[model samples]
Structure formats: structure tokens, C-alpha cells
Target: MTDVTEEFRLNLAHIDGPLAIATLTGDLDLHTAPGLRTGALEWIGQGHHHLILDLRGVGFCDSSGLSALIGVWHSAKQAGGALELAAAPDRLTRMLTLTGLDSLLTVHPTAQDVLSTHRPTADA
Candidate 1:
């Protein structure tokens, strides 16, 4: 992969069943938030109500990113599903906690936790 690809800012991988993953790298800020919004909506439209965002690779995130996260959370809740974040950086975790969204959104320790701890919901 070239340096640009290696510097991946974001990626979304849709899985069967209810869960989909949004992997991010570089910085998740205002400039890149639109992409996140679009990708997340696509998965939601595809019947993936449950989402696990693997944010370990993300090096930075501002309020815009947090807005996107909240957007996903609300979208899932609206669709009768849940959106979880896996392995978020300390800063992101702190941000979510400070914003009081931590209690609203689910969080896991790792990507593996997404599968291992997943419980098939009745709604989605």
C-alpha cells in the first residue's frame, strides 16, 4: 500500500447479521466527518443496526468526530439497534465521558470483543 492508503482516515466493512465495523486512522475531524456520516448511513440503510466502530487506529478526533459518533448512536437507537465503539483511544474515551455520551453508547475493549461479546438482539 502507498503512504496515502497506509494513512487511511477511515474504512467501513459491513458484515452479515447485525453488526458492521467502521475502522478509522489518521485524524477524524471536521474535514473527514462527512465521510463517516455517509458510510454509517449506508450500513444503517443496509439493515445493519448494530455497529462496532474500531477506532483504535484513529490518531485524532475533534468535536466533529464526536458528533458523528453521536449521530451513529442516535441512528442505531432510532432503528432499534445499538452502536458500540471498540478500543477507542484514551482521549476519545475521555471526550465521550465528559460529553456524557459514554453512558448512552456501548464500548468494548477490542475488536475481538465485538464478536465474542455480541448478543443477538431481538429487535435487530
Candidate 2:
């Protein structure tokens, strides 16, 4: 098997609005979760108030990955922002639902789904 470190990739980009997008591909287990966490912190530190983790390419996610996601969510909330998941594969979506995390994590069928629903306030 390939080294998990080499198997993961996280791409960062900014949308037209206040949203920052982190597109994740590959396995998200113990070996790869830290990258996700680090990317989230960097985005938050850069003053991004909204983030979307686009998981359309992710093939797997373990417990540690789930924990990292939750941590990022809390960090965003503490920063007065929000974190959302987009285009999650069916397996990952099922895992979220089975863990009862579906209620806590905002998930959309596509990044556009979140973008369409998330309108900036007049103040923003």
C-alpha cells in the first residue's frame, strides 16, 4: 500500500463570496487526518468566516477523521464562523448518519447546494 501521507491531497480555494473551499481527496484516516486539521486552522487563521470541505473525491474516513472534522467545526464556531461538508460520498454520508453527526454537521449534496442556500447577511 502507498504511504497514507502520499495518498491524501487537500486543495484550497476561495469562492466568489466569503467562503473558502477545501477540496479533499483520498483516504481520511489516522495517517491523513492531521492534514485536514492543519488546513482548517490555516484557513481560520487567515480570517475565513465560512469553509466548505468538499469531499467528492474522498474514498474513506475513519474515526480519527471524524474527530478532526468535529474539531474543525468547533474551531469555526469559536471563530464566529461555520464549517460545512459538500459532495460527500455515500459511504461517508452513511457514516455520519450512523454516528448521529449528521445533525451537527451541515452537509449538502453539492458545494453549489450550500452556496445557493447560504446568502450573506446585509451586514456582510
Candidate 3:
């Protein structure tokens, strides 16, 4: 079996108020998805509720990875937060669209775009 962690990398790029930006690189598949979910959930648990997943570095993502994205979205919502995707590759965008997840999750042109548009509420 291939060791997915060797090929995959997830880095928390930035954090501000309730928002966190995570950069995902390499392939996201069955083995790597769980780590992404766990790491994002841990951030949420630590009070960074709104998450922006920067997918610009991601080379590939399989069905399991898509499922993990949904899981993270659900978990974020349950925590009264939200999940957004940034700079998704065309293939991943098509997958999300085909799976009907595009309608459910917001997609941005870039992580900076998300950061520019986000307005932190006084309560947050």
C-alpha cells in the first residue's frame, strides 16, 4: 500500500478571528482524507470555525476526498461555522459540480479573494 502522508501535505496558512485558511497539497484520497478531516475539525474545535481550504496546491482528489470535504463542511456547520473552497482545480470543480456539492459549498477564485470579502462580525 502507498503511504499517502508522504505525498500529501496540509498546512494552516493563516488564521484571523474565526477564520482559518489551510493549504492542501498533493493527492487527496482514501488514506489522506481522514487526516484532512481530523486536522480541520481540530481547528474548529479550537475556535476557528470558518474555514477556507486552499486547493491550489492539490494535484488530485478522489471520491473519498470529496466525501472528506463534505464531512468537514457538515462538521463546520454543526459548530456554527462554514467551509469554503479556494482555487479548486478544474477537475475537482467538475467533480464537485457532478456530485452536486458545488451548490452546497462556496468556491472562490483564490484564498486572497475569500479573505478580502470576509467581514468578521463583532460577535465573532
Candidate 4:
């Protein structure tokens, strides 16, 4: 498990096609949400709209994490893009599902699944 005390780190990469994926580790709370937002926006601004977030290593997530995701979704949508979650832990899945976000956002069992199979919808 990652040290929860440390700040979350965002790692970026491009998979097949223009899909830009960010793998997040550590806790995603209010303090780190802004950075997450900025990083994602920077990628989107660069003409990368397909996003896959790998959250399997995330030890903890608060409202800030959820908020950050919502913000990314809205921002990506405005640019005609889509954001999908990959390898979300059960805790995160439960948290998102309880709030009905599971349906709104695509959730995959693993990053590879999202990377290989995800096709952006027409509406984005």
C-alpha cells in the first residue's frame, strides 16, 4: 500500500491512439484536487480528449477526489472528450456508486480493458 501521508502523484502517458492516461497514487483530497484538475486540463488543452484514470493504487479519496473527477468530466465534455475510470478499488467504486456516479462515468476492471476497448461515444 502507498503511504497515505504523502501527497498524491500524477503520472501521465499516452496509450494507443490519442488516449492520455493518468495513474494516480496516494490520497486525493482537497489539497491535491487542484493539481489533479490542472494536470488533466493541461492534457485536454493539448488536444487529448480521451482520458483514463487508473486509481487502483489510491489508498484514500475524499469529496475532493470526487469533486476533481466531476470537474474533469465537465471540462472534458466541454472540449468534446470523455473521461473513464480504470481499476477503481472497491471502496472507491462503492463511494462513487452510492452517489450514482458509477453510471455517469465509465468504470473498467483494469486500465488495459479501458485502453483496449474504450471507444468514445458520439456525445462524449
Candidate 5:
């Protein structure tokens, strides 16, 4: 069995005030989805609510990965923050649309675009 971390990488970066960019790489499957969820939740817990998931490097994402995304969105929302997707692959976008998650989660063309447009206020 492949190690979860070996198959996936989640790099968190703080950009544009309260916004956090989680740049994910590699396949996001059942083996690695939990780590993504946990890392995002930890970031949110630390008061970084506004999150942008940079999925450009993500080559594959399965149902479990989608579920983790939803869970992260909910966690961010509950923390008075928002979640957005940047540079998602075409297949992931299609899956999101098919599952109706596209409506619930905001998708941006690129992380730089999101940084330019969104200016989230710091939590008081």
C-alpha cells in the first residue's frame, strides 16, 4: 500500500489577509482525503476561515475527495469564513457540477484571480 503522504501533498499558504491557499498535489482518493480534511480544519480552527483550494496540481479526485472538500467548506462556513476552488481540473469541475456542489462552492479560474478580487476581513 502506498503511503498517504507519498501520494498526496497539501501545502498551506497565507495570502491576502484572512485567506489561506491550500495547494494540493497528486491524487486525492480514499487514502489521502482524510489528511486534506484534517489539515484544512486545523487551518480553519486557527482562525483562517477564508480558504482557497488550489487544485491545479491535483491530477485526480474521487468521491471521498469531494466529500472532504464539502466537509472543509462546511467547516470554514461555520467559522465565519468562505471556501473557494482555484484552477480545478476539468473532470473535477464536471463532477462538482454533476453532484450540484458547484453551486454550493465557489470556483475561480485561478488563485491569483481570487487574490485580486477577494479581500476578506480579519475575524474580530
Candidate 6:
């Protein structure tokens, strides 16, 4: 059988405030995981204190990709920021749940939820 290959794309957009969103497309395997990590760190380095990963377009993810995510989460926390995943695929969610990482990594139903939940209160 011939081998099939997938292209990975990571796109970042900064919202009106301190929030930045990274939209990932294609498979998130060992080859693509580095791109995701680089994109996220680039945004954080740009002074974005809050990050949301939009994984709706991600069709596949392997252990390496998940490990990269955990690393990114640690980077965010060390920078005094937070990382959240929005619209993660069912398979990814199940993996996180089974591995007990669902609690460590915040998962939101939608990007809007990420914004609303992390948005700074008026009093703050």
C-alpha cells in the first residue's frame, strides 16, 4: 500500500485583548507537533498572556502531539499565562480523559467560552 501524508498548519490570531488563538489544521503527529509548539510560544513571546488552541480542524493526534501540548501548557504557566483547548476533536478528548489529563488541560466547548472564561473582570 502507498503511504499517505498530511500537511500541518498552525495559524495564530490575537484577539482585541490579551487573548490569542492558535488554529491547528491537519494531523498533529510527531512531525507536526513542533509547529504547534513554536506557534504557541511565538504568540506568548509577543506578550499575549492568554492563549486558546482551536483544534476543531485537527483530524488526528498522537502521543507526541499530546506531549507537546503539555509542554506548551507549562510554558504558558511559567509566563504567568494560561493555555486552553477549544473545539478539540472527540478522539483527542477521549485520549485526554483516559489519560487523566483532561483536568490538567482546560478544555472548552467553544472559542467563545475560552474568551469569556478567561476574560478579565471589570473589577480586576
Please list the residue runs of candidate 5 whose C-alpha ends up more than 4 Å from where it truly belongs after superposition. 1-6
Q: Give one digit per residue, the lDDT tens place, for model 3 in 1-124.
A: 7555347889999988789999999889888999999999999999898999999988888889999999999999998888999999889999989888899788999999988988667456
Full-model lDDT for every candidate: 0.80, 0.84, 0.89, 0.83, 0.87, 0.83
Weakest 10 consecutive residues, lDDT, candidate 2?
115-124
User: Number of clashes in model 2?
Assistant: 0
Candidates 3 and 6: which is better by TM-score? 3
lDDT by residue (tens digit), candidate 2, 25-108: 989989999999998988887777588899998988888899999999999888878899999888878889998999988789
Score residue 27 of candidate 6 by CA lDDT. Answer: 89
When superposed on Cα atoms, how far off is each prediction in RMSD?
4.2, 2.2, 1.9, 3.5, 2.4, 2.5
lDDT of 5: 0.87
Clash count in backbone of candidate 1: 0
Model 3 poorest 10 in a row by lDDT = 1-10
Expressed as tens digits, the lDDT of each residue in 1-124 for candidate 5 is: 7544346899986655567898999988898999999999888887788999999999888889999999999999998888999999999999999989999888899999988988886652
Runs off by more than 4 Å, candidate 4: 1-5, 15-17, 119-124
Q: Candidate 6 — which residues are off by over 4 angstroms?
A: 1-5, 121-124
Better of 1 and 3 by lDDT: 3
Off by over 4 Å in 2: 1-6, 122-124
Model 1 lDDT tens row, 1-124: 3222234466775475777777877777777777888888888888888888898888888888899889988988898778899999899999988888899876789878887888666556
Q: Clashes in model 2: which pairs?
A: none
Looking at model 5, report the run of 10 residues with the lowest lDDT sum.
1-10
TM-score for each prediction? 0.86, 0.88, 0.92, 0.87, 0.90, 0.88
**How high a TM-score does candidate 3 get?**
0.92
Candidate achieving higher lDDT, 5 or 6? 5
Specify the highest-lDDT model's number. 3
**Global local distance difference test of model 6:** 0.83
Give the poorly placed runs of model 1, Cα more than 4 Å off: 1-8, 121-123
Q: Using TM-score as the measure, what is the rank order of every candidate, best first? A: 3, 5, 6, 2, 4, 1
